[model samples]
Target chain A: MKKILNDPAAVVAQSLLGLAAAHPDLLRVTTDPAVVSRADGPRPGKVAVVSGGGSGHEPLHGGFVGPGMLDAACPGAVFTSPTPDQIQAAVSRVDGGAGVLLLVKNYTGDVLNFETAAELLAADGVDVRTVLIDDDVAVRDSLYTAGRRGVGATVLVEKVVGAAAEAGADLATCERVARAAVAGARSMGIALTAPTVPHVGEPSFTLADDEMEVGIGIHGEPGRRRERLTDADGVVAALLEPVLADLPFAAGDEVLLFTNSMGGTPLLELYLAHGIAEQSLVDKGITVTRRLVGPYVTSLEMQGMSLTLLRLDDELTRLWDAPVRTAALRWGA
Target chain B: MKKILNDPAAVVAQSLLGLAAAHPDLLRVTTDPAVVSRADGPRPGKVAVVSGGGSGHEPLHGGFVGPGMLDAACPGAVFTSPTPDQIQAAVSRVDGGAGVLLLVKNYTGDVLNFETAAELLAADGVDVRTVLIDDDVAVRDSLYTAGRRGVGATVLVEKVVGAAAEAGADLATCERVARAAVAGARSMGIALTAPTVPHVGEPSFTLADDEMEVGIGIHGEPGRRRERLTDADGVVAALLEPVLADLPFAAGDEVLLFTNSMGGTPLLELYLAHGIAEQSLVDKGITVTRRLVGPYVTSLEMQGMSLTLLRLDDELTRLWDAPVRTAALRWGA
Candidate 1:
């Protein structure tokens, strides 16, 4: 595969080094047990937020670590869950006296490892809670996940819960806010091209020039089905139809619309997708109160985009509007 | 080509509509003339900054139109310069009585059109000055450019000059600061793949699986030469070496190191490149005091990255740290 990397095996370590170099004022990276923490972390009386998964979906766990977002992030290798030791190390480093909240995406390896970390941390008398995000409507079950695979909504969970934690919420309140975000949100994505894992050096799946995957997962896994390529509007309809129906959002309900690129899609296309997605939601009587359009959570050079809708309540809206300063997803800071 | 678009002919207009919809709080788009202006613009007594070019390099001219940046932006068709009338219309709309500063990239069409617009606005009794950015150290001359092709440094120009404008610099002062930025900055890029123009329906160029182009332009134009694909470090070395030597940056000098994605390169790779580029600079005894990484300027999904180094004085450094809130670049705001 054509990738800008030093060694396939060193992708995670090297990229983290780069990330640390790029944002030294914002992040601090620790080796041995790899974890990225806020430069001035361990806020004396605030609940610490930690999140992680595979490394490919950048700007997710690591990029989201900062003042009003994740306090620490433990990134594993591409598409592989971080080990329990790594997660525990991250949690320990960022856990202020208040408590610690772990945002775990609903993947088997991630769930197992984060749970193990939580148990290990609890043994040390640290208050720890885990919030699972499974907002992808594309899958009912998968080879690597049960229920649904977490996708774009992980960003929403992190943002809202991070805000709550920053606002002096206790562990229970932060956990509740995170759960609310997951409950109110749904996401779906499609792939025009598959991404290659660096170590594998080949695409996990293949698609013809005239075909696209309708409900592709983030890790280049097979989606719900393959279909002939269509226009932006048609693709938006297919993805949003399932998401809107699943959420059963009613007229006049306010929501935050997030259009995310899967990696290789340009902002030009993502903005076009945002326009189409916004119109589709408006036609359904939903009011898009806030809109975020970019490559937030992405695969490795995968040409695709995902639509996420988070039905907003007053409290959720307030939390969503809070100041956040991270490598990615910064506003009002 | 697989792209998220409607009719290729409508790409620019539709995408601008999406951009307007997504950032109505920050931007406003006017059709016919097709100008994107700040939602609260024409700040009286402050020099207005206006920029424009071809459409494909997003978040450059358009996304950079907001508070503390461009007061207006005019976008042409993909990879095609906007007409003179469009530029004039934007200039007229944002001339807040303190005169207007036009930041033009050094492309043949862009320079011609922006110059024509400057004359038109001048004849209309509005004071106007133009600053040209030609920092690309790629080709000394090319098919579409005379001196050097303006590449990634246009973003730096807009940002530094925009900050100066927001700080109440007069038209002449803004022009001077912009010219200084252009003089002190140099950039070079390499492409792993070419981008396809939407209407063209084919890549502007092609490369073998083991080949890559070095010192490439943003429009997929040929670079310095084609060479065997290499690791990220080798590529970074090839790019930074030329840029550093061209600027002849000296030891003890502080610089803003910018590593930009041509388009399709992921944040993972960009951060890796940033690390490599920063080390190369430090090795030369130059101190990198600031960094701006990511796809600030891009070709439409081209797989490449560029390195830009802006020699910073105290004024440029202070202006760089100034609060500016644009759609793409935001910090300390």
Candidate 2:
């Protein structure tokens, strides 16, 4: 692909510098390629929270480095998981005296990388806890590969858990909140068009004009199955039924409803899907206490969207309601 | 268009209900049909700031409502401008005893609708002002139409103004800050694929695999011109030159840079663009103080991106640094 970059290899490094330069008050990038943290370091007695993922999901890991969210985030190359060395640096940089927690989305590469970093931190006695988010419902029951590919619910997990951490929750408390968020959330996505990975100038997968792929992964992985084109409502139902059924959420359940664009679908259609999904939940007598509709967790400009629901309780609600000041999820300050 | 909505007319209403239910504490759907605001009225003595546009830009007006960004947002149909009545409703609902300011993007329909509403609010003896956001560098010297259509800078205007409003700036101060933000900002966008409006199932425009449309509007409106597809670096240069030349920013000037996805571009591409754009700025010796890369203000699902630059001063920097808590933009507590 014809790109404007100076050197493909230098993309991540230069971007981090620009990010730090942009929000000096909110973020600080290490001179050596180690970590991206809040402009200020680990607040006293506040258990620091850290997370890392592949680079493409900007604002997810980096934009999220601020007061209310992750204390620090490590970014890797496009859709490629961060190296353990980078994760270890972020862990060391954000480790306040109170300890630290690592929130890892359940991808094979991320799981392995974060796990290795945890071992490294443990060796350093920097007290650490790991919370894995495996929330995507797209991947069907699997005896061979793991079940769901963690997708949209990662944002809610971070926000709720970040609030807990920011409130000076102990590492255990923060980990509990993060785990609860992961357990309560479910997400599924569908794609109308396959995305083109920059390194590869062609589409990752192809779909006919009259066809759409359901249950696709964030990296253009094949979905559960393909079907003839369907309207937004049908797509919503298709996406939501599996999530709702998998979670076994019943009537009167209070949940957070999220409709995420896979980088490509417009918010117009997401709202349309959101409308149908709302009615679907209302008809089922479920109550959604909050709704977040946007491209929170995305696949690079792939024309698709995912619906995520997080069942909420008074505690979860309080955490969700608490003030946050991150670059991505911010509210109630 | 094939849609999931039970009725096209009910889309906004139902979505509002879902939004309110999901964020009862953060947002309320007023009795006036399409207006959504903070559950509570505006803070007394603070400038009541309101923004509204077509509904396709999710998280723009509504998602931005909170303590620091927008006091209220009036949502309209998919791509149609919100009626004056809707804007008026938003003004009355968010107006504290002090007054209200309307941040209208420079789209002809949006400008007309908001201006009429401002006049209506004036008739009620409600203090009001409007800042026209003509930030797009694409449209030039049009005698018949308003200059360039407002693209991404509208969000920066709201953020800076919202900070001023939150800091207890009176209406005039808020207005001054907002207008300054609009004046100092310039943006340009390019489209890789045409977005399909929800009601209009077909693509808004067509492009060959080897072509990309430059200087495009967020709503899939045509750009000043189209060009052969280029690499990410080339695309960034194509977008930045016009914005830089139009503003003629100096070498020592600090800037707040924004790389906004038109809806469909992925984060990886966005970061790559950010990496390249920052280098270009460095080569030019420009001081970039803040950087934001995300799907902040998006078109429905146009496969494109926009670059925005805001030359900053001390007062503007302070306003940008002020604490904000909203569904989208949040800062210090």
Instruction: Give the runs in model 2 whose Cα sits over 4 Å from its true position.
Output: A1-14, A28-35, A38-48, A95-100, A113-129, A140-144, A160-177, B1-18, B30-33, B42-47, B95-100, B115-128, B141-144, B165-171
Q: If you superpose only chain B onto the true chain B, what TM-score does each candidate give? A: 0.99, 0.95
Tens-place lDDT digits, model 1, residues A173-267: 99999999999999999999998898999998999999999999999888799999999998899899899889777889899999999989999
What does the i-RMS of model 1 come to? 0.9
| Candidate-wise lDDT, in order | 0.91, 0.79
Docking band of candidate 2: acceptable
lDDT for A91 (candidate 2) = 76
Q: How accurate is candidate 2 locally (lDDT)?
A: 0.79
Q: Model 2 residue A139 lDDT?
A: 79
DockQ of each: 0.80, 0.39
> Tens digits of per-residue lDDT for model 1 on B1-333?
999889999988889889998998899898678899998977899899999999899878899988777899999999999999999889878789999998988999999999888888888898998888999998988999999989898988998899999988898999999999999999999999999999999999999988889999999999899999999999999998898888788888899999999888988888888998898888989999999989988999999999999999999999888888988988777
TM-score of chain B taken alone, candidate 2: 0.95
- Best candidate (score: lDDT): 1
- How does candidate 2 fare on TM-score? 0.87
Clash count list over all predictions: 0, 16
